[model samples]
Target chain A: AQTVTQSQPEMSVQEAETVTLSCTYDTSESNYYLFWYKQPPSRQMILVIRQEAYKQQNATENRFSVNFQKAAKSFSLKISDSQLGDTAMYFCAFMNIGGSQGNLIFGKGTKLSVKP
Target chain B: EPEVTQTPSHQVTQMGQEVILRCVPISNHLYFYWYRQILGQKVEFLVSFYNNEISEKSEIFDDQFSVERPDGSNFTLKIRSTKLEDSAMYFCASIPPGLAGEQFFGPGTRLTVL
Candidate 1:
C-alpha cells in the first residue's frame, strides 16, 4: 500500500512571488512516478508537473517545478512567479509504473491562494 | 488540445435510485479510469478499464457499481442504487499508450445523492 501526505493544509503567496508546497509519500516500490495536479474553482484537475523516481534530476515545466528527493521520499512542487490563476487545491500523486494498474494515490491536497 | 470529457456535469438523485455517469476519453487513449473525491477528501481510484474490460478495481467498487464502454467513444459508470455516501465528484481519466504515467482527467461530474 502507498500513501501520499501533504503536510501543508493551506499556502498563500503574493502575486509574482514564489511558493512551495510540500508533499511526502511512503512507497515500497522502487520504480514509480510522482505527479503534481492542480484543481481550480472549476474543479478541473490539471497536471502541473511529473517526476520519475529513476530520474535524479527534478522536473520543470515553465513556472512549475518539482524538488524530488527520492532518498527522503519527498516530492515538493514549486510555483515561481506565481499569479492569481495559480490559486487552487494542489495534490500530490503517486503511481506505480510497472503495475497491472496505473491508478493514482493522491494526497489530501494543499489549498493555495495567490493574493494580489 | 485533446482532453477527456464527461457528461451531466451535475447529477442529483434520490436514495436507492440508479444513476449513470458518462465520459468520453481522449480518442487515442488506450487506458481509462474512474475516480471519486468526496467533499474535503482525497481523490480515490474506483476502477480502471482497458480492452473493453475492467483490469483493476478498488475495494470501494462494490457490486453496486459498474462500468461500460457502450460505444466507440463513450465510457460510463453506473450505480445500481444510490446512497448518500455515494455523493461526490466523479472524474474520468485516460492515458495514451505511449504515455505510461500521464493520465488526463475530465472536468468531473458532481453527483449529489439525497
Candidate 2:
C-alpha cells in the first residue's frame, strides 16, 4: 500500500513570497503519479500540480511547481509569488498508474496561511 | 471548463436512515470514483466504477454502501443505514479515458449523520 506523508502541519508565507510544502511517500511501484491538491474554505479539492514518476523534469503550472525526487520518494510542492488566495489546506497524493483503478492516496494535509 | 458536479451540497440525516448522494461526472469521462473525508482527516477512496462495473473498492466500502449509474449522467452512492461514523464530506471524481492519472474532482457533499 502506498502512503503519503506531509510532515508540515501548518505553514505561513508572506504575500508575494515563495513557499514550499514538503511531502514524502512510500511506494514500491516504479511508475506512479504524485500530486498536490488545494482545499479552500469551500472544501473543494483543486489540483495544484502533478508529477509523473517517470519524468525526470518537475511539473509546473503557473505559480505552482513540484520537486520530485523519485530515488528519495519525495515530492514537494512549491508556490512561487504566493498570493492570499493560496491560503488553504494542501494535500499530497499518490496514485499507481498501473492498477486497475488508480485511486488516490492522500496525506494528512498542510494548512497554509498567506499573510498580507 | 468541464467538471464533475455533485448534488445535495449538504445532507443531514438521522442514524439508521438511508441517504443517497449523487454525482454528474464530465460528459466524456469513462472512470468514476467516490471518496470521503472525515473531519480533520485525509480523503479516503471508497470505490471506483468504470464501464458500468466496479473496477476497484476499498475495505471501507462495505455491503452497507452501494453505487449506481442507473442514468448515464448521474452516478449515485447510497448508504443503506447511516451511522455516526458515516458523517463526512463525500467527493465524486472522474477521469476521461486516456487520462489515467489526472482526475477532476467534484465540490463534494457534506453528509452529517446525527
Candidate 3:
C-alpha cells in the first residue's frame, strides 16, 4: 500500500514571497511517480509538476518546482515569486509506474493563501 | 491542447434520488477515471475504466455506485440512491495509452444531495 502525507494543513505567504509545501510518501516500489497538483477555488485539479523516482534530478515548471528526495521519500513543492493567483490547495500524489491501473493516491492537501 | 470535459457543473438532488455525472475525456484517450472530494477533504479515487470495463475501484465505490461508457466518448457514473455524504465534487480524468500518471482532469461536477 502507498500513502501520501502533507504535513502542513494550511499556510500563508505574502505576494512575491516564496513558500514551500512539504510532502512525504511511503512506498516500497522502486519505480514510481510523484506529482504536485493544484486545485483552485474553481475546484479543478491541475497538474503542477511531476518527478520520476528513477530520475535523480528534480522537476521544475515555471514558478513551480519540486525537490524530490528519493531516498527519503520526500517530494516537496516550492513556489517562487508567488502571486495572488497561486492561492489554492496543493495536493501531493503518487503512482506506481508498473501498474496497469494508473490510479493516483493523493495526500490530504495543504491550503495555501497568498496575501497581497 | 486536448482537454477533458464534464457536464452539469452543479446538480442538486433529494435523498434517494438517482444522479448521473457525465464526462467526455480527450478524444484519443483510452483510460478514464472518477474521483471524488468531500468538503475540505482530500481527493479520493472512486473507480477507473479501461477498455470498456472497470480496471480498478476503491472501497468507497459500493453497490450503490455504478459506471458505464454507454457511448464511445461519454463516460458516466450513476448513483442509485443519493446520500447526504455523496454531496461532493466529482472529477473526471483521462490518460492516453502511453502516459504514465499524467492524467488530465475536467473542471468537475459538484453534486449536492439533500
Per residue, candidate 1 scores C-alpha lDDT tens digits across A87-107 of: 999999999877757889999
True contacts kept of 3: 0.82
Where model 2 places Cα greater than 4 Å from the true spot, the runs are none
**Which lDDT tens digits does candidate 3 get at residues A55-94?**
9988999999899988899999999999999999999999
TM-score of every model versus the real structure: 0.98, 0.98, 0.98
Off by over 4 Å in 1: none
Candidate with better DockQ, 1 vs 3: 1
Between prediction 2 and prediction 3, the one with superior DockQ is: 2
- Which candidate achieves the best lDDT against the true structure? 1
lDDT of 2 by residue, B1-114 (tens): 888999999999999999999999999999999999999999999999999989999999999999999998999999989999999999999998975688899999999999
What's the true lDDT of residue B108 in model 2? 99
lDDT tens digits, residues B1-114, model 1? 888999999999999999999999999998999999998888999999999999999999999999999999999999988999999999999999945888999999999999
Question: All models: lDDT?
Answer: 0.95, 0.94, 0.94
Least well predicted 10-residue stretch by lDDT in candidate 3 chain B: B94-103
DockQ winner? 2
Tell me which residue pairs clash in candidate 1.
none
Chain B TM-score for the candidates in order:
0.98, 0.98, 0.97
